[model samples]
Target: MTDQGLGKDDKTPRTARGERTRRALLAAAAQEFGEKGFHEGSISGITRRAGCALGSFYTYFDTKDDIFRALVADMSGQVRDYVSPRIAEARDGIDAERIGLLSFLEFARSHKELYRIIDESEFVDAAAYRAHYENTAARVATRLAKAAERGEVRPDVEEVHAWAIMGMNVFLGLRYGIWDDSRPADEIAAIANALIEKGIGTRPD
Candidate 1:
């Protein structure tokens, strides 16, 4: 996995240090939760795995649930940031969907642990997980609506189409990023993009 976390490379010393510590804690928490589930995962175990003092954990997060929420927010932001620029760059192109797919697949590859935690959270708390998922889907739908207004996608297509496409990417990430790592990222993304474009993109006369 790529070291994309804000660690030694950040600008502000304090911010950088805090981000490093937070990343460490999240990494440890992901492992603990993966092995034992949320209820069984202990703060002491997470602190120990993170190699940080118990007191330090409280400085950043109040409770395990808080950390879990942070993890979800962070992962969602990462995915949005990954795809936003690519979508913006596409501007008026037919390949915006492809670019978005590749960006998402790349983010999943770099942040597999975070992705796993997000996926696992669904099974742990179905209602809360669905709420979070819907929020993310809504954001994607808004972006797609804007793109459609700009003539990047078919104008007749509804925002639900974008929600469905985002769901497809999430499931694709689960399969390629977590279940199997054999397939190339580009290939997987291309296949996904092809399906979406053919299904919803505007066709020229």
Candidate 2:
């Protein structure tokens, strides 16, 4: 009845428990969605898989669509977390490009579920998906710009080049990482790094 709603002690435990339940649900939802596309997935199925009640799903998400959106956001954040540090260490120019390419492949290998979700989402919801992809590319471009300024890559290279390199990684992930037979993640990363760096590396006059 008070502004605390259920009172202090009650509210605290409820909030903590709710958060834990919500995170579990989302984790399960991401796995389900990645395995089965959004259209084929259901709230009941997600809740069942998560071991939560039907009504509890609404406490965290109003609908399946809401859950999907949240999953995309979470997956994007995970990718950024995985790649940002490696990119940060690339203060040396060529190493920046090498790091960026390798980091992307490694991230995909580490989070294949999230990567599959992202890839499928792009075709079904191009606008929302592209916005997130472009934002990531922009961040990578900033790193590339710094490297270019330091003579790491060709000065004439544009941010689009960064986006292109990222695209190559995405397709490679689709073909080799996700679909093809197992190969070492490092070996795949090395192949991608070679392709991107060779194309982008500075050439002597």
Candidate 3:
């Protein structure tokens, strides 16, 4: 896949050192935007936080909006990278869904600023915001379709089911991971997974 994490006009970093510097800038941007927001976040602030010279900023990013857009895409990839391996460890399709939710909660707790950056992206970079969710839902849909082929889930499972699960996980992360973490992540995942196993309707009508 193309590095959507880079600015539209920016080229990929060549040397290992260049790659490290670029990653450092992205990390700093996350904290900058997470605390002050896109409108208030400054290039100088990111450079200072990254421990790089102000001139170094121009080498990686063209403008503040460019970095902010890149940050949103970067964070989206971070979440997927963290959770994908755990999801792969699941024994079956349903268990994979459960593992996915549990990993996401853990990630949210550790990266509290995730919500701030992603939520603000809706206004600062609408395209990146929509792409984030759309890409995630597509992954879920692909998984569900594979499970159907394996006879691990209902044959009729489709894209609608993928989006439904995504919606449930997003809100659950906000409520349990951001608002509060008094509840156990595994416990929450188990409760949600049952809905996948058994329809929530009064009967399978």
Off by over 4 Å in 2: 1-14, 200-205
Candidate achieving the largest lDDT: 3
* Alpha-carbon lDDT of model 2: 0.74
Q: Write the per-residue lDDT of candidate 3 for residues 24-134, one digit (tens) a residue.
A: 999999999989998998999999999999877777777888889889999999999999999999999999999999999999988989999999989988999999999
**Hey, what RMSD does candidate 2 come out at?**
5.0
- Single out the weakest 10-residue window by summed lDDT for candidate 1: 1-10
Candidate 1, 1-205: lDDT as tens digits: 1133433233222677887998898778877876777778889999999999998787677678766766666666777777887778874534666677777777777766756577667866565577767877786677677777888777876767868877887788778876786889889877776776665557784
Q: TM-scores for all candidates?
A: 0.76, 0.81, 0.92
Ranking by TM-score: 3, 2, 1
The lDDT of each candidate is: 0.73, 0.74, 0.91
Local lDDT at 13 for model 2: 22
Clashes of each: 0, 0, 0
Q: Candidate 3 has what TM-score? A: 0.92
Off by over 4 Å in 3: 1-10, 201-205
